[model samples]
Target: MSKRIQVTFTKEQWSMIEKFRGILGESDAELIRNIVLIWLSEKSIITTKIKKEMDDENGNRN
Candidate 1:
């Protein structure tokens, strides 16, 4: 299952995000998803399976 979210950012913050998005070649959704997944992984809130899946999606291996 998936959930939708609404986020509000200041103009400067949005500009930064836009800049990084362009440089990283990521769409808004992909950038936000990767950010959230990274946070979850850092906080140890995601399962090993999810971590593996995320790593695989990012073409990373450990």
Candidate 2:
């Protein structure tokens, strides 16, 4: 199963995406999907690191 999301962008933001899409040869949806996936992956890594650091500070090393 999959989920759907709706996002809104300013005209300038969209124009930048359109220019980048032309260079990458991706549709708007495809570009947004890739961007979201990459962001989520990076966010997960950062969150994990922060949690580990907090655990270490609390002397909960594992």
Candidate 3:
């Protein structure tokens, strides 16, 4: 039901996460999750879902 991913941040990146988490009151994992989701949402797996529905309606193969 859930996945745990491990990441190794560079010194500068770890510092940034600490700074970000301090303000957000979240762990580094939560902070990274939000950041990545926001980025992915702009060009994400959702696109495949949308395309699938459209093709189903139009009977087109892709």
Q: Which candidate number has the best TM-score?
A: 3
Per-residue alpha-carbon lDDT of candidate 3 for residues 1-62, written as tens digits (9 for 90 to 100): 58998888899987877776755558777888876766776768558788689788899877
lDDT of 2 at 60: 100
Between candidates 1 and 3, the one scoring higher on lDDT is: 1
Residue 6 miss distance in model 1 (angstroms): 2.0
Over 4 Å off, model 2 = 22-25, 42-62
lDDT measured at residue 58 in model 1 versus the true structure, 0 to 100: 93
lDDT of 2: 0.78
For model 1 the local lDDT of residue 37 reads: 71
lDDT for each residue of candidate 2 in 1-53, tens digit (9 for 90 to 100): 57778899999998877876855458777788777766776778547787789
- Per-residue accuracy of model 1 over 1-62 as CA lDDT, tens digit each: 68888898899987877876855458887777777777887899998998799899899988
In model 1, the Cα lDDT at residue 57 comes to 88
Checking candidate 1 for backbone clashes, the offending pairs are none
Q: What's the TM-score of every candidate structure?
A: 0.53, 0.51, 0.55
lDDT of 2 at 38: 67
Identify the superior model by lDDT, candidate 2 or candidate 3.
Answer: 2
RMSD of each: 4.6, 8.5, 7.6
